[model samples]
Each structure stands twice: as C-alpha cells, then as structure tokens.
Target chain A: DAGITQSPRHKVTETGTPVTLRCHQTENHRYMYWYRQDPGHGLRLIHYSYGVKDTDKGEVSDGYSVSRSKTEDFLLTLESATSSQTSVYFCAIRGDSFQETQYFGPGTRLLVL
Target chain B: AQTVTQSQPEMSVQEAETVTLSCTYDTSENNYYLFWYKQPPSRQMILVIRQEAYKQQNATENRFSVNFQKAAKSFSLKISDSQLGDTAMYFCAFGQVAGGGAQKLVFGQGTRLTINP
Candidate 1:
C-alpha cells in the first residue's frame, strides 16, 4: 500500500473561520489531487499539483486553495469556512505513467456550523 | 467536456451472487481512459478496474471485470461472487489521455451497492 496520511481526520469549525487540511505521502508520486465527496454527488476535484510549486484548479476550485512545496506534502486550505464546505475530503497520488491507478488517503471529514 | 453517468442510484445483491453496475460516459475525444473506484464505509477510495478506450478487450481484476464498449460509450463493471466486503459506493470516472501534465478525473454521481449477508 502507498504510504499516504491525512492530518486532522476530523474537524469542526465555525463559519468564517480558517481551516487547513494536510496530505503527506511517503511515495514520491508526481501527481497529487484534492477532492471533496458529498451525498448525491461523486468525488469532485478541487485542486491538484503536478510537481512541487506547480498546481492547478479543478472543477470545484472555489473556496479552496492548495500548495505543494515538496513532493511528499500537499496542503489544502479553506480561506473562510462555510456551511456548504462541510464534506469529506480525500487526497490521491498517482505516478507519471499514463493509465496509472491513483492511490487514495483515508480522508478528512470537515464540518462547518 | 466529458461527463460520466451512473443511472442506478442504489442496488443490492445477495452474497455469493453476481451483480453488474452500469456506467455510461459522454466524450468527444476518441482516446481516453475509464475507471471504476470503490469507496467503502471507511471512505477510502480504491481502484476496482480500468479500461483504455484504445483497447478492444475488456479489463478484469480478479473478482472485478469491466465491459468496455467504446463505440457505444459504455463501460460497466461486473462483480462475480460478491462478498460483504463489496458493499460500498461505486464511482465511474473518466480521464483524458496523458499529454498535458495535469489530468483531472471527472466522476459520476455514484451508485450505492449493498451486499446482503
């Protein structure tokens, strides 16, 4: 199994507060992605990084930002938490090879009130 | 733009039985990749199977197999001898061919599968 860990497995914050979720991978994968899962909707991509300092927005990039300063670490931050942002977030890593399957982290559940 | 569709919102199967999950996608690109991911109650997403549009033969992984029909834009997953561990939310995803450095996965709504013991 790929070594991937998500810090703060569960969090509860008030609206308008700042929240940060961290994803650390022991496998030096070139591709890292952040996604949110909600009921009735599948996992929606929020942000992804191809390499250190190289990041891009995904389908649901609003209200979220990401950074990757090192190959093993990827961080997702919510500038200001909102009730709508409450959901389960997952981090995935994949190799540079085409058609490679992604390995996912356990996931972080966030609740905003 | 590419989109994945899973018509069945929920399904149930008896243990030791065979069950098939449906997935259909819309894409203009001739070459791409399709994947099935299983998210168990633990919320860990695991890859079940994958199919490349360029490949004519379907892809199978142990108890999981996929029926890939490129012309019809359909890719469905079949699970043989289902077990209680198979209960989870299944998502069908589509990804573009690897040319660009960044490839984002587009996912379907997801189908909840319950395996009865």
Candidate 2:
C-alpha cells in the first residue's frame, strides 16, 4: 500500500484474450516488480524494471511481458490469457538504496475462464 | 538462484504467548537481505522484519524479532506477546542488493499462523 495502486483490482476474462495490469507508484522508486500469487506458490516473480525503459524477465516470465516507459509506471501484459494465468497479481516497489525494503500494492485478482 | 524455505506450513499460538517461525535459505551471494512478510486476511503484504546478511545483530521491530544465523543459512521470526490480529500468512523472502540497489525478491511458500484468544 506504499503509494502504489494496481488497476482493475478484480477482473474476469476469457481464455485467449489479452490482459494488461498496470502498476503506478508515487514513491518514484527505482525498482518495480510484477509477481503472481497462487495457492501452492506463495509468490513468483514475473517481470521487473530497474529504471525507465529497462526491464528484465524473472523465473516465471515465460507467459508474461512487461514495459516501463516511465519511472512511475510498470505494466504487465499477458498476450493471450490462459486458465493457468488466473491468479492474484502483486506489484512491489523499492527505493534506490540498498537497504530499502520493498513495499507491495493491494493486488489484482485475475480469473480466466 | 536463491531459494527461501519456510518449513512450517501452519502454526497456532495462544494470546500473550510466543511463537517462532522458521525459515532457511540458500544463497551464495555474500551481500543480500532477508525479510519476513505478513499477509493478513485482506491479503496485504506487510513487512514484519528484515535482516541484512552482513549485519551480525539480529533485527527487531517491537514484538517481532529475527534470529539470523548466516553460517547456518537460517533466519527465524519470533513473535512475542502474540495477539489475535497476528493470525495471518507469513512469508520469508530473499533478495540481492546490487550497486544501484535494485532488488528482486524470491519468496517462500508461506506459513499460515493462527493466533487464538
């Protein structure tokens, strides 16, 4: 809840549809991350950005893509939503210091049928 | 890749008592950070405590404290004077702090804790 907000907190979509989740931060932190939370998997990183226009893939980034055109906004996109992609997504941001703790947003619950 | 493990899937504690949650991690990096996060029923991820690998002193935040043993690769969270509101899912996470301080966290499966009054 650290001045971060995720759009479409709840969404129900159909398979094969495109879905995008937006994370906006007022903290102006240097790091932003996208993660998915499932029953067995507590949280898995999907994508992350270190700076504006700089992005990288994470352990579970295969089916996801991300973009950060600006420092305050990081976007995660599912090109073709699948049932497996249904889960609660979380966005987190960290300050520009090594000792800074990461803060999370509320979360977005995506359901695909 | 660094991996965090929270062995306890669930735990229970009575009000005003104490409970300890165990977490172990694997990391070859010498400089890193370990964190304990609490997720309430509302599903908000809140930071309970944090310890730096280089810091020999254990980290404490009010009733929450951590015992960090770098040699044992262990980091455990101890909650003193437990309250009903402490009932929640707790997750252990690890991250590497780069030169720019950019961080990416790797989390554990989480331990669900129930505090009964």
Candidate 3:
C-alpha cells in the first residue's frame, strides 16, 4: 500500500457527457499511471505522467486524456463518455528505479448509459 | 511488439492444494520484465511476483514462485498451500521501456482461480 487513492470509487454517466477520474497519491512518487481493466483484455494503460505537466499517451489513449498539475494528483478525462469506454480504471505509482513493482489504488468502476 | 498469453481462463483447487498457472509471451527485446498480478473481489490490483528477463534464477515470494524460462519465453506462477484468500483473477504482463522511457505493459487475458473448501 503506497497511499494511493482514486476518487469516485463508482460512477454512472450518460453517453455524450463528460467524465473525469482522479488519482491521488501521498507517496510523492515521480511516476504515475492510469490503466483501464476490461474483461478478457485484462488491463491496458491509458496514460502516464513522468512529472508535473509531463504526460504521455499509452496503448489505449485514443478517447482519454491525462493531466498532472502537481506531484500529488493525476487526472484522467474523457471528453465525451461513451458506452464502450465503460470499465474499471486503476491508478498506480512507481517508487524507485531499482524495482519495477508499481503499487496500485483500489480502482474506479465507471458505467455509461 | 510484445504479447502475453495466459492459456488457463479458470482453475479450481481444494484448500491447501498446489496450483500452477501458465503464461507465455512473445518479445524481441533482450531486456524486459514479467509480472503476475492478483485482483481480488475488492478490485485492488496486487503484485504477486515479478521476474526480470536478464535474471537466470526464478523469482519467488513466500508461497508464490515463478518458473521463468527465458529461452522458452514462458513465466508461470506456482502457488503452494493455496488458501481461500487466493481466489481471485490473476493476470500476467510483459513490460519494457517505451519511447518515452516509461514502462509499457501488455497484459494477458487473465485467469480466474477459485479455492474450494
């Protein structure tokens, strides 16, 4: 447990509406990541940040955007929510360079109507 | 490009039994990492074990150990003394440095394991 938390453990939104998920970490880690877990596909990275204001796209970054204004918070935004985008999103942090072990948050389950 | 495959979609075993989950990957990179993650009903992703491609010896943690065959491109997790607490969805992933130096991962489909009483 690296003191990571995700906001709105559960959320329901209508298609075409905007949605944003927040990932907060008290670990003060240099690296932060956002991933979406879908049945049969396991988990896929949506986006990641190496530092404040430094973000990069992931394998599945088409419909998602991320912003890191400070070291403590990273936000993932879906400009327009879609039913296909419904999935459980997880936040993670990497503490050191020696170990590749990334600690994860509880996860946020989003449902689109 | 890299891909990880977990052939077993589900498995069940009696408590205190031993269980092995299969995982295979395709990669051309010389340096990379393999990992097993457990997701319980609570939906928390927990790292069970990790294996470095360059390491010759398999990695283990307590009751969990990995059979890492680099030449075969296989990494399997064997859980000894399985308990009800081990019931969860297990996922295997392949990782390497991406274009931006951030670790990128490709995960397997996942295996649902159940520990029976």
Identify the leading candidate in terms of lDDT.
Answer: 2
Q: What TM-score do all the candidates reach, one by one? A: 0.96, 0.97, 0.97
Per-model RMSD to reference: 1.3, 1.2, 1.1
Query: Local error of candidate 1 at A75, Å?
Result: 0.6
Per-residue alpha-carbon lDDT of candidate 2 for residues B47-78, written as tens digits (9 for 90 to 100): 99999998999999999999999999999999
Show model 1 residue runs off by greater than 4 Å: B97-100
Q: Write the per-residue lDDT of candidate 2 for residues A1-113, one digit (tens) a residue.
A: 58999998999999999999999999989899999999977999888888988888888998899999999999999999999999999999998887889999999999999
lDDT of each: 0.91, 0.93, 0.92
Candidate 3 lDDT tens digits, A3-98: 999999999999999999999999888889999999889999999888889899888999899999999999999999999999999999986473
Better of 1 and 2 by lDDT: 2
Clashing pairs in 1: none
Worst 10 residues of 3 chain A by lDDT: A94-103
lDDT string, candidate 1, B2-116, tens digits: 8899999999999999999999999999878899999888888988988888899999999999999898999999999999999999999998743246667889999999999
Mind giving the per-residue lDDT tens digits that candidate 3 earns over B1-117? 788999999999999999999999999999998999999999899999999988999999999999999999999999999999999999999987864466777899999999999
Give the Cα error of residue A102 in candidate 3, in Å. Answer: 0.9
Q: Rank the candidates by DockQ, best first.
A: 1, 2, 3
Considering the true interface contacts (CA pairs under 8 Å between chains A and B), give the fraction that model 2 also has.
0.74
